[model samples]
Each structure stands twice: as C-alpha cells, then as structure tokens.
Target: MSFSSILGYFLGGYFALVISLFMLSSVVPVAGFAARTLSAYISIVICATYGVLASIFLRIVGREQIAQWTTARAFKYVMAITIGITFEVDDPKRHLDTVRPAVFIGNHQSELDVLMLGCIFPKYCSVTAKKALKYVPFLGWFMALSGTIFIDRKNSKDARQAMAGAAKEIQTRKQSVYIFPEGTRSYAKDPGLLPFKKGAFHLAVQAGVPIVPVVAANYSHVLYIKDYIFRSGKIPVKVLDPIPTTGLKPEDVDELTRSTRELMLKEIVALTQKVQNRPIAIPATSGDGVVHASGADATLS
Candidate 1:
C-alpha cells in the first residue's frame, strides 16, 4: 500500500475510537436508549467526516483510487473498530476476474449494508442509490464524487432515465453496478426479505450482463432497536454465481427476478439458521461451479 493508503487506514481506526470514546463520555450523564442513540449518531458523523476527507484527498492525488482507499480499506477499518462489524466473503476469484460487466443485486437490511458491500465488491464498481441520499452531508458528498448513480424514485420518468444511463455506463465502461433491489430497509422483527423492485433486473437485461446476487446475513439480531441498545457481531456475506442475461429479453425480467430472489432467500434463511444455531442443510454445488451456498471466510480489516 502507498503511504496515503496506510495513513488512511490508521486515521480511520483512530477516528472511530476517538469518536466512540467522546460519545461514551458525553453520554455518561444521560441514560437508557437516548444515550445509545446519541453515541451511534456520533460514531456515524465522525466516520463520515473521515470518509469525506479521504475521498477528497484521493480525488486530488489519484481520482481513480478514491473508492479503493475510502470504501475498501478505510471504511472497513472504521466499521471494524466502531461497530465490531466483520465480513466472511465468498470466493470472489472466479467472478471478480470476469471481463463482462455485471449488475450486483444485494439484500438491504440497514444503512450498514452499503459499508459491507463496499468492502467486498470488485474494483471499478459504482453504486445505485436513492437520490435523497445525495443530501446526507459528508457521505453524500463522497458518493457523488465516486460517480454513484442516484435515482429519484419519486419520479418514474426520471428514475427510468437514470437507470438507462447506468446501464449505458456499465456497457460502455465495463464497470459493474451494485444495487439494492429491495429499495428500502427491512424493519421486521424476524429474518425476512422484502419483495424486490424490478429496476436492477431490468438493468441487467438491458446491459446484457449477468446478475450477481449478494446475501448479507440478517443483522437484526445485532442492531435491532427493540432488543439491544447496540451489539457487535460478525456479518457473513455470500456472493452467489452470476446468472447470465445473454439472449434475454425484457419480457423475461419477471422470471429472472423471481429465480434470483428465491436463490437469495434460500441462502439468507440458511445463514440465519446457522447464526441461530438451528439445523439447516448445507448448500450443494452444481457442475457449472455455481453452488447454492459457497464462500471462503474473510475479515475485512
């Protein structure tokens, strides 16, 4: 790693620890849920500020390396230090080396999903997120700098145009796009997924790229509001084999979406069961190297 990259990693962890301690001390007089909430927000703000600064610095010195340092390295360090968030990524060697661009669809559980995905996603990948996130201070500023595609969901016409532009970028630049097909976070008490929106599937078909499904183990057990103030644990992420969209038409979107959802849902259920210490069937591998469940354990930082 370069000197700047090393400095970024150190600063990320330092900022996280400093902010966490300050918040804990400041909230000592306060009690209960309010204190925990305040601490969480404080940690978020500090980490976000660090991210924005790193993004700006990288953009100035090496524009192409911003996401590599900020998201893949620095942000991973911050999350590990602040929230005890770690990842076990699946075997990415086969998929990450593909020449063709792909659409990465993942389950959305909380805002933290973005951080986790950023750490594991392949290089040259950009994110598709709600347009409103553009207003979220430092984080939003960094996202805009990173060329993230933002969709205005309130306006169908605008959203379609944005999606089309994203698809064009994927094809022309051979860059992958990561999107949350769920459109919003799931707040349910149990392990479940929301019905996916069709935009990501549509994009894959339009771009004639594969759809890579990413499943993040349910984090409700760690950060659910009703249960605990704030807990720390591992977040296992599984990246499944890519489903090709070759020779596929727009009409096939529903089937594609359904099949992909089923694949991800099964994985999520199995992951949840494993976490809860319940008996669950291990995923089997197919002849094509696509397994129902397959991945190697990896810690982000």
Candidate 2:
C-alpha cells in the first residue's frame, strides 16, 4: 500500500534470489558456473552498495583519502565471503608499508581485481581508473568520492594532464597511487603480463618517488569469462622491491618501465605456477591465509 512496502519487498526478493543462487552454486555441479557467475555479480553489487555508504560517511568527515581503503576492505571481506576467493599477498620486504608518496604498478586482470586490491592496498593510497568509469553510478560515485585518479587513456593530452595532477597530489598530500601499466586487463588464462605503458613510470619520475612493482598471479584459470569458469580459490600477489627514481629523467622512464615489467612478469609466472601445482585443499578453504597484519609475512591492511 505504501512506497516503503514496495521497496522492502523488492529488496527482500533480490536478497532471496542471491541466497538461492549461492545454494545452487554450492551443490549443483551442472549449474555451478552459471550460478556462481550470477552470484558473483550480485555480490559485487552488494559490496559496491556498502562501499558507497561507507565512503560517503568517511568523505563527509573529511577522510576522503582513505575512503577507497574503507571500501576496498569491504570488497575483500564481502566478496571473499560471498564469492569464495582469497587474495593472498606476499610482501616479504614490506615495501608496501615503507613506501610513501610512491607510484605502485600491478598487472591488470578482470573486474575481479577488487578482491586483490582489498587484500593488498596500503593505507593513504588510491587507484587510477579510466576516465570513463567516473560515470558508472554507485561504483563510480564511490571511486570519485574516494579520490580515484581518472585518466582519459585514449587522449594522450588528457592522460598526461591527469598524471601530472596525480604527481602533484603525491607531492602535496603524500599519497600513494596504484596504476595498471598494462593499461588494460589481460584476461588471459595463464600467468603473463602485457606490454606496459610508461605513464606510471613517468609519474614516479616526476613525483620523485619510488616505483613499487606489485604483482598478482594470473587467476584467469579461476575466473574465465569466456568459459564461464568461476571457482573459489586463492589469488597470490606479491609486492616487489621499490625501484628508486632519484635523478631519473623522462628519457629514462622507458628503461625503468621495461625492466620493472620484466621483473614482475617473472614473479607473476612463478607465483602462478606455485598456485597451480599446489594440491587442492581437501575440504576446500576460502579466504586469505597469508597473515594480513601480524606474522612473518606482515602484509599491511
């Protein structure tokens, strides 16, 4: 009879459907992929909604810089719980914590990278996105509120201007930024890297910060849109040693980007091989095991 009643019914129905799909994905072998995929989509919507709310509150309180960090943890928690995946980041050197006002680069995968970002993103850091994503409703709103740097990848002029602005932010705010040098998701079924664009490298050089190479093992085998394969498993990520940009000029960005990609490519392939060859858990465990805050790994939250 009332608007609230209708809205309540719709919300109830949507959640009921998501729960049913999750149940089917668990037991129905023939329908697992389809059910899981749909459930994953719903899970993202749920997390994004949570992110929008959380980030908004944080932004209103003038903590907009860590807004993405708040939302990323939600993504890692909600998606890992609902979708059954763990992002295990192995940063032995703890460069992720020590590095500040730096440029971090990682291999790009699919839309599922939210899980990875949640697992590995350090505090006071935000990611760069294509300018197009600045208008995708709730997710876009969350990104914009959380200080995501948007670049128009197709237009060199706009892209450079965005990077220049990013460099300035790094200097003034002492913020760290993440970029995908591949400039796009690989979506490949194996561990590999695409040719890197030099934007991130140039930004690091201009900002006079170190370039930290973070790598996530290829989980295309776990999440293959082409084959509709959505399995619950771990995505291994490692944060490599940061390469300094002191005294580095624009002309040197090319070699820096090239060498960093080569090193990350090697580590990515190695991590993927380890994840692939490892024996599947008997009872199947989901959620990150690599200690987040304490323990030998000491991966920062």
Candidate 3:
C-alpha cells in the first residue's frame, strides 16, 4: 500500500514483460526446441549479469540500502511473477530474529515456492534444490552466484552427502537454508507435511540451528508444476514461531521434526480457516536479523 511497494510492483512488471517475451520467442517452434533453449540461455545470461551488477552496486554504494532494496525487489519480483502467472502470493515470517542460520521448512504445494521464498529472504540465504535446476540457464547461474545448495536426488548417497554439505554451509556460513520437507509439492489441502524426511531435520540438528516452519496455501490452485502458466488468487504464506534447539542434539532430530511437522499442520488448518472466513494478512517481515559470532547459536532461546 506504500508508494515504494507500488513503485516496485511497476518496476517488476516491466522486467517480467521482458522476460516473458524472451520466453515466448525462445519457445515458439519456428526456431526449434534447441534454438529456443539456446535463446533462453542467452536471456538468462543477461539476467544474471544484471543481478551481479546490482549486487555489486548495492555492496559498494550502501550495504543497508541495498539490503532494503533487495528486500523490496524480492517482493516486487514475487509479485510480478505472481502477476505474470495471473496469481497472487502472500509472504509472512515469524521469529525472524532467531531465523538466521536456521533451517527453513515450508509446506510444499507448488513449484512457485522457490521464487516466493527467495523473494522473502535476504540474498545470502540458500535453498536446498534438486540437481535438475542446475540445467536451467539464468536460474542455475544465479543459484551458483547466490550460493544455492543443489542435491542429486537420483543418487541416494550423493543426495545425502549434498544434504550434509548444505547443513555444513548453514552452520559455517550462518545463512538461512530453505527446504520442502514433503520432498514434493502436494495437491491436497492439509496434506499433512508428507512425513518429514530425515534429511532436512538431520541437517538442522547437525547445524545446531532452529527450524522455522512456514505454511503456504492456495499456491497449487494458482500454478501447478505440470504447467508454467500463472493464475491469480490470494496465496497466503505464514511463518510460524520457530522451534528452538538450545540444548538439542542430533539424537533429537526425529522429535524436533515431528513436533515441527505437527505445528505446521496446525498452521495450515488455521490458514485454511482464515481463507474460508475472512481476509488474512501475511506480514512482510518477521524475526530479528541477528547472527552469533560463534556458529553454534541457540538464539531461538
């Protein structure tokens, strides 16, 4: 509702138009799939270049100003992408001060979760992604530069190792890591977290970090992974209070995961109720942005 948000929305709309045009030109068969792929690659390179330049400018000019702008840009891009797909998304984060260097577990409902979450967090945060995304043109490069952690989902051992490495990064780098515990997007309401896989939680416990649970609704209805088109509707995202791990050990991973999963399910139920009854406001930001000097932070306490 502020002037800045409105301005950001407009700026993002322009960027979205450009990207969409490139997407179409590269896809339309006159050039062939290979050519389209190549075109997409070129377009991605340009976008990556822009991202790098912006990052540099922000770092050099004023770190705080850039952080603020990046925050707004994240919102703008998510809003633009939502608009591009004719859908809407809401973002909310709770216990943000205790959020840094913690594992972020979100309800997996659609493919758009990556973009939505990326926009919500600061740039240093990473998403533990599948290896397939590495093949994406601009996305892959951006991921590389942005320090995204990718795992080879096909190879169990490799995936486990990648998860371990990602956990290490979260601990050592003191960065936020996002993962979808369900392993895949769900099509049903209150799908109940698809059972928290041990990978994400194991990493959290290993890193001695808290788990910040997020509940997202109406994303699947807006855009399904099977297709890339956009749809418009209110997609509410809620970040719940984080589960602390002050005295936690790896042995408690299962209990932590289970409790967080149950709590997230409850949040989903509440979000569903809000959707059915009245408007819900997803907070633009939450948590205090703090990082401990020693990597072993029990900040959530």
Best by TM-score: 2
Across 164-258, the per-residue lDDT of candidate 2 in tens digits comes to 66677789988899877776787977766666666777778878999888888779778988877788888888898889999998667667866
Error of 3 at 166 (Å): 3.1
Better of 2 and 3 by lDDT: 2
Which residue pairs in model 3 clash with each other? 85-230, 85-231, 86-231, 86-232, 87-231, 87-232, 96-287, 96-288, 97-287, 97-288
**lDDT, each prediction:** 0.65, 0.74, 0.55
Error of model 1, residue 149, in angstroms: 2.5
Model 2 lDDT-worst window of ten: 292-301
Give Cα distance to truth, residue 283, candidate 1, Å: 18
Error of 1 at 241 (Å): 0.4
lDDT digits (tens) for residues 1-301 of candidate 3: 9999997897677556545655564555322323323333443344446666665555566442233225334544544543443223343443544467787777777545544554455444566666677779866655554556655444444223445656666777677777777666666433344555656776777677877777775544455434443344556667776777777765666577666766777677667656656443432212221212212112111
Higher-ranked by lDDT: 1 or 3? 1
Candidate 1 lDDT, 5-97, residue by residue in tens: 998997777656555654664455223334444444555666667666766776777564335435555556666765566667775655754
lDDT of 3: 0.55
Candidate 1 residue pairs in backbone clash: 90-295
Count of clashing residue pairs in every prediction: 1, 0, 10
Give the range of the ten consecutive residues with the poorest summed lDDT in model 1: 292-301
RMSD (Cα, Å) of model 3: 12.0
Predicted model with the maximum lDDT: 2
Superposing every Cα of model 2 onto the true structure, what RMSD results? 9.4
